[model samples]
Target chain A: MSGIQKNIIKTLLLIALFMLSENMNAQTCCAAGAPIGSYLEIQTGDKRLFSFQFRYEYNNVNRLVENENRIENDPRTRYGQSFLWKLDFSLNKKLAFSAIVPFVHQSRNTISEQQSSFGIGDFSFITQYTHFKGRFRSLNISAGIKFPTGKTNHRADSQILLSPDMQSGTGSFDFIFRSSASKTFSSLPFLTSYASALFRLNGMNNDFGSTSTFVGRQFAFGDEVNSQIGARYLLTLKSGFLTPDIGLKIRWANHNLEQQQAAPNSGGYWLSLPLGVSFAPNEKKSIAFTAELPLYQKLSGLQITTAFRLGFQINYTFQKNKTDDILN
Target chain B: MKNLLFLTILLLFGCNKDDNQAQTDWLIPFDEVLDGGPGKDGIPSVDAPQFDNVSDISFLNDNDLVIGMFHNGVSKAYPHQILDWHEIVNDDLSDISYALTYCPLTGTGIAWDRVIDGSKTSFGVSGKLYNTNLMPYDRATDSYWSQIRLDCVNGTQINKVINTYPIIETTWSTWKAAYPNSEVMNLTTGSNRNYGSYPYGDYRTNHSNIIFPVSNTDDRLPAKERALIVMGDQTKKVYSIELFAEDRAIEDTIDGTTIIVIGSKSKNFIVAYEKGNLTEVVAVTDQLPTIATDTNGNRINLDGTIESGPLQDVQLTTFNSFIGYFFALGAFYEVEIYE
Candidate 1:
């Protein structure tokens, strides 16, 4: 117990030191290093503009059980880090093109289980076309194709949590498409809301079954895609340096097979309240960060959770004058 | 302009500044809400939590499924159908004692040992359970019950705690009643408007004057010969020493403790003097080496202070909408434990 306490103190000290250093270094987003947000987007704020973004994110998840049970570990923790780069260019005023590629490095292993596990996750590619562009907002429909970049077969020494299905990659092609648009508020304080609906057409993969004990691993299912609706309120503070954003998102997807077998289709709905702030250093350079909390997910045998997202944005100003003209 | 940027930076990094007062609401405590307990309905739920898939492996022989670890080996097949939905249904059968675990969130299924019969074993999920992963632990408690910072426990506000209960039922009304004084920070996340909406069991309103762990109380006396003491509002015990002795009170013993009866109906509870300390409570399984961990997986706090702030509130209310069902179903991954 004392050791635990000491470790806690050490962790706090480390955090304090990190914070202290962070203050001394003002990391304003630049083209040099991109951390999971807007850095690489080209001509993002204008019509007929080119854009790209590179993102890097780290996720830490742990599931612990109380009561020592005096038994070996029954908990699992996973740290997943990802690198994503995206490119989007408006082919013309009415048509647009976009692509996203992701690279991931993760080890799904457990110390208590005395088992070591590693794998890569599935990778995806997306392309889209703008069907319409309104005076205040524009609409684009995109088509996405995903490749199975993950390992379907993974074995370990002892027991662990990294399952084949849970691998960082899925070795198969999943076709998807989406339509997205964003409109800034006409009100005094800057407020903009965006909405997108994405669809997934399931692909065939032979890696799951024969290696798994799950039912769906035997046969491929039909199409499955997630439709997400989100809206954000960004209040451009009088100073314009800090803009706080409060957003809400709801997602619906089809992922359960047994229930689907029962109802030909059984899906789920997730409600999340995203709260964060956006920082604009100059008129053309800005960043938005948000935290996503799971409000409610009606499911069984699952622990309630609170998940969050921290995003940053650095828009590239190419042909600044033309971009400004487009915005006007 | 740069000066303004400095001020915004200061506001963003601040932590734990305005938190001082603690809740004193007598009606219901905040812990009852932030800390979850067993739910009302144990078996099935109205939401009909989706069960992804099921596979019957009863045909596998012991050699195919069982594996040797510390002192004994485990043959991992049973009640797979029941586990398909509940994920964590515990039972002691075939002389095999284990707790079933499943994460509907990640759709991962795995089993844990309650009392290791022979050897200590640390097994991971098969290639199937995707969302199913490892847990965090500390030496003080068995790694069995601890977790990392973001780990999810069975029934706790922080989403991380000891995993014991399989299902956790949360409701906004009950939480509000539990902490009426606390503000409703997020009307959407949860509201303080409703209370007592727990579906499984109500908060324990009636506690014995002398409950478990607490030593001095009238209820501890033998029922047969014990006295009934009631207090108005005086804070002090009005009738601390009331005696109504009966024949059985002195002569009989229930479950080893001497019983004392009082009142005509014998309806009054019993009391007994400490006849020697109660039997030693069984310690946590001591075989496995303990790993240091905190409730949230950081090292335990030395001063026993709360590492994270008080547990936050979880919204128990569920909402649905159109087009929400087109997604959320399908195979995410597979987990195979037994052969």
Candidate 2:
């Protein structure tokens, strides 16, 4: 196949991979960062592109258990919502850079106490590099830094320190590492598969000066590892192509530590199933939607579980000039 | 992978203020106490308590608990519904300022006189717990006083014990019957808090375990069993309410001081008064009775006054006391039980 045909096929495979893999961040208390869909693929050819994305996520916490015992219902329940903006820029085909900025709102209500917080959440910057290329497969690796830019010093009733989960930010810097691979089936022309793995290392927040907890003691969120695999089938249409994708994502995390000791009820594991559809009218634009259902989840302690989640995105691809190689 | 390793090493070594130990001169060692989540005044102590006539109270159930206080002919009841949320109420009755402190965890309540250093002040919840007891802080010095200990454990005024007034812990129905014309705390606390629900779910009923750590434990009784406790300068005594109800009345001596514990199971009320070699004390009536006959065949009113006898002018001192959980009495005081 020609280079142009190979590039088109690669792009199609990526479109399918994103639909199945892009879902939520781990739904842990006080966790930050964007959903998986926000991750951009590394371009290996000498084609430059830029895109922007907006996303919103929400969770309602109604159940909590401690040490395997379910906590009884309280007059208070927590609701967490986040808005994120992601920017992706392909510096060159071989390298890419992406940045995400988020705003978070959290609210909790109890008998005499009703509190809410809204502010910018943590920000992340990532760089992706194409490491290898083969006859029908490509590999990319990525590294990123998450900055503690969100608001952390929020109080309820002007004096009470809200729990870390209620704060918009974790007040800590984190490091991220990820790798992904995609392959096109030679026998099945319209089919492709992709897989990816990621790890995040959380740093200690020095400003954890809440009179509660350990006074002046620092806290670090537990490290996290997430992996997913998915496949997509392409169906030809009169105007564009319709792609249906399915994937499963699994995440494992350690308990958040305080003053070098593991904080109780702070960590767990989860598995989720993502189903999605993408419709592209032409090579220049496409729209996608995904609905994630939790298949199996067993948290470390009692926690608010996700009933379901939904996400949508619109993409418009633009080239600086009509590439002579693409039109030829 | 190499870049990931390098960044990890940099972050591990790039320590910030978290690397240094914080400078805190905690009067009470850090490990002995636990943060109750809310900061100072987080639970919000009532500085101005409002009351409505018994006829106006619509929220309390007959079985709900209340703290009844009486002074200089004025009587009022503070419902646990309000205390369950605020934990402390700073108010004045008969011109005497007091901090009515209640700890939900230990089911203990006490009225502390707020006169410190000759000036009156208010108290607030410190959002700190010691042995599952409430720790109140005075606004005058920000000193945290252990609710059961009744002494400042941290901050200025350390080691100072405030004077304690007397209070009675009884069911709302019992209190209303005793003082039919008394006023009850109104739920309109101005903070827009729900007055109907308990914030901690099943906590009052689940005595199997405590949410926070306590320093001591005694298996003499269940953690939640109610006990009438009396604390003297150097002596402490406990009478289990279950046994008190079974016996109705008991005369016991502790540390060479003899006292009489009287119980009315139907009214769910208990009180202790000093006894001096009295041969017999019998009630003339039942169910909220007011007349009793002492060993000398003298008629006595509920207030321990001689209505008829040679000792007509003599009066028995009723020690200032409150009824709380058996676990709290055992946890905080060196107790001599009157079985």
Candidate 3:
């Protein structure tokens, strides 16, 4: 197969791997992925339930603009890819640790394409505390910082990765903080209403891309902060042994960096809704899968990227109380 | 109690009601809602960059002009929104002369005539913020230091604001003077786009500042503290930026994480203004800079940074080609000094 076809296949496989891992185990308090249907598990006080999870994905970096205004793909630099890995550990019902490392493979392409690429992508680490049941339903809040651990060079701007042209890392440090509130309801025998809103804070990342275009040097990515929030709902088949689920989500985000100058100071709202599914062979090991397709992308015209992320997770339930998880 | 337990169990294993349909698409465009012109909000109605002549400050073309140019087949003057905000912004390479004049802090475009004063050439932020300059036009009040005029801003003796500077020279004169030390480069010679004085070469990180003159004094608006870059769109459009820093540094105030912006006292990060839009993306640098000591013996980071693009004759959405990415459609240069 041509390199472009292979890359598309690889990207899909990576998504499959990510989704499968999310629900591989069902009993752990913090599975490989977040709770499939938004069942908030608050650590109100000292309720000890623990687990660990991780996710890794790599996207073949190739950008092609179609004549019909559609961005296309090229096979020459098929090796170019975006590699990302996530590690998560739940201390108990109330706390969790998150770490992510992203890499922009500049040398993956032939020497010709390499001439325009830039520096390495960065890494992020965050740890949050969950207040199982605070004032409302289950609420979770996490705060952490993103460090510029990747390389910074303008040598990689030529890649088809997406804009704000971050080939590698922009040597500036960024801090990220997120607060989330969720309430899940069993509205019907097989339906669950899951809603959660997150407030995210982003710091500046100004290593400047490979080119001296005015935007890169504007800040360090310059000192700025931005926010994004999303909410989702899922449907499940609560049968004897296997529990399968499906759902949707909506998200709104805004950003104001030293860049995006002509845009509104605040920003236009972006809305995204995803349909997802979750299943469990048994209570001890539960599985969740999801696909996020942007309903509307008004903010960044990163078009030609008919992009969607498929995620899967599995978690093993620990000690159970009643008949269901107890017997398993 | 049994029902409560059953309810909890149901809640944990219930299904979600959202759809998972799949389809392919680019970003939705706002051309229709945008109404082919500037919005009442002093900004483009659509956030995305417009490539045709349907917007302000654009080049002249039936499809490109939002309001047709002042004269056909010639480099036209700027639109009111562009002019109202930025009174003068100069580029030293192109035959046509443009001045983006306005102040985010002062909240006015200043004035045009040298007598009005209080104006300075508005340049783009350093990088992709929206690069709109291919050369530098020395600016002060509405008047620029003109190599075009031998007298300079002698017309305005008004000390009230920045009412004086030098007269802006034409492209040939400006480059002849700005780069007298180095081999001069001019993109306007091809005769395809012969308006304004600015350079357009291949995509790059470095080019001479092709600077002419803005005003007499620094205008007290430090380069770093001034507005970010503004890049032009295909439709004579401009994308603006309002990059803000903390109002006060740690030395200026006590313990605080306040964003620290340009105006607020407590200090904070805020978006104070917006400029042009980015069509194509590229950086220009004579030489990349790192932190170093200045000739004045002060510790500083001297970066030969310049942001420029819009590779002429290309649409913003149509910029996915390697050739388009590398071609120098427009030019921009700036020397940033940070301590």
Candidate 4:
């Protein structure tokens, strides 16, 4: 056997290993801050490299569902849009740090009432480390903390405080853990397969609806697990590389707890398929567009679930040249 | 530099200010009114409800609770399975229009006349709660009415009291056996909802589960235990269904007025009426519209109607009474338990 064939075998083995380790947990049913996984895709390079990315996301939730069945003709609908800015700095070949800031706007509409809220969302800071690096595959692990920076006490036009799901932030400090792996085969040099899993351990917000009293005011978003697997193929162009990717994502969340009891219609499992295309004009800049469609959902109780999601991202990298490194 | 400026501008645009808040002059304490998660009409009300004969209905379990109403020689049953999803049902029968309102959190059900000041209008769930009970709103005047308070607490019709009708809430099997020819509200409520499922999980049986804060808490009985409460001038008395282990009746004087309470624990029903001429009342069985009889040969039904004897077809004036969760009754009124 040649070295190329050996590399292909190694890549296939890595893919199989990660696929078997995928964790299947549940997800929350309402709008939240953008998942940390969306901003964890950092490119491994030399030290002193810095990158910035901005993303816009739009989600529409209108389908009223009970368990796995869709209840048709529901007039209630919710729309969420978010703008996120992310910054990344590489300390070495194996270590990196990232920070993200988000702004979110949400609206819910029925035949008789319309409510909209907008504000700054929660902020997150993550530290990622490259655990394994080989010619055929690489593995990255990340851990982060989310701050309760968003406004949770926003009231509606009627002066009634909006529900937790409608607020821009969760009002709770949360912990996020993720592991991602990517592989490239020698026979298919332009194709790459990747898999990632993320788990968010949520904290409790003692001042969920009212800041005045704590008797029955505690609210905690359910912990969530999101996993995805996919492959991307790159097409080389004269000025850039155009890459198209598709993936199957499974998300599961436990029911939210209100006053130490599980809240109804709050959490469930969701399976979605995401497709995206990215254009890297050069190594320093890239733009990507993605669309996610929910294929199946089994919510804990009755809830309005996501119909579809659209996202656009722009990335810019600042490279540290030899002269800059010498100056430092 | 330009990119950062543009992003800063975008983030500034995301911060919104609400300057068009609706001015509310609430008759009740405004801070006590809490949002029930779903917005107004989020839990849609049944406007043009569909019905099926009791024999044709199959979605309800034998032990499932129902709200039964009788008027103009016709009987109807509204299952809690349906009411658990749609808390209000607006219906008309033989020129009588009323709304059946049930609050899942508080476990209280009442029937209110749809006519307000001689104008007919339907009611919708306001998605607001007082003492964790439902607050319904009239479609005509957009006024919020407390289900347990039986009065408008907000909007144009503040402080207006609604007239209520008498209803007997019992198990589906018991109601079906007594009123087999009754019409039941079916699942075809036009709005798609899961009628087979109880929306609140374990809330009916969990003694310690109270989702929202109550103004008053009573540990005399479990919070979710159902009891019949009769309201008088500045007085409220509670009669636990468990007190009637067998078919029995109790004559008690409350607020200087004599009242008769008839109930059966096995049948899961309790009804009360002002004692005017009722004498020698005793429990009877297997007679439709005749759960009790008197020595004067008068057969009394669940609706306090006299079916025979000297007062045939005459209706007994009922005291303001209804079945509610013990915690809810305690929250609204300082209730005295009838031993």
DockQ of each: 0.02, 0.07, 0.01, 0.22
TM-score of each prediction:
0.40, 0.57, 0.38, 0.90
What would the per-residue lDDT of candidate 3 be over residues B46-134, giving only the tens digit for each residue? 11112222222223322110111111112222222232222233332132223333322111222123222233233221111112211
Q: Highest TM-score: which candidate?
A: 4
Model 3: what is its DockQ?
Answer: 0.01
Best by DockQ: 4
Give stretches of model 4 more than 4 Å off.
A1-32, A211-216, A320-328, B2-24, B286-288
Task: List TM-score (chain A only) for every prediction.
Answer: 0.62, 0.77, 0.54, 0.86
Query: Candidates' interface RMSDs, in order?
Result: 21.7, 11.2, 19.4, 10.1
Kindly give the stretch of ten consecutive residues in candidate 3 chain A with the minimal lDDT sum.
A26-35
Candidate 1 lDDT tens digits, A1-328: 3463344345434533443443234111001011121222223334456543434454442322111111122233444444454555765555545555443433334333322222223445555565555545656676766676544433322122123323334445767777677676566334556566666665555534231232323213344444444554444456556656555656554533221121111234556675666665445444555455656553222321224444433333222333321210
Task: Rank the models by TM-score, top first.
Answer: 4, 2, 1, 3
| Candidates ranked, most accurate by lDDT first | 4, 2, 1, 3
Model 2 chain B, poorest ten-residue lDDT window? B11-20
Residue-level lDDT tens digits of model 4 in A1-328: 4463354345434432332221011011123565556567666565678877777788888778889999897868888877777888877768889988776667777777887766667889989898866656889899999999876656666676667787778989999999998888999987888899999999998866553332436778899999999988888899887999899999999988877788877789999999999987767667889989999998988988889989988776776432111100
lDDT of candidate 2 over A1-328, digit per residue (tens): 5464455446534532332222122111133334543244533345677655445566555555333334454334666666655666776656878877665656565443456655557778889887765546768889998898766655444233445556667889889899888787899867778798899898988656344443444567789988889887778899887888888988778877655556544677778887778877765455677777776666664355455666665554454332211100
Model 2 scores a TM of: 0.57
Instruction: Give the total clashing residue pairs for model 4.
Output: 5
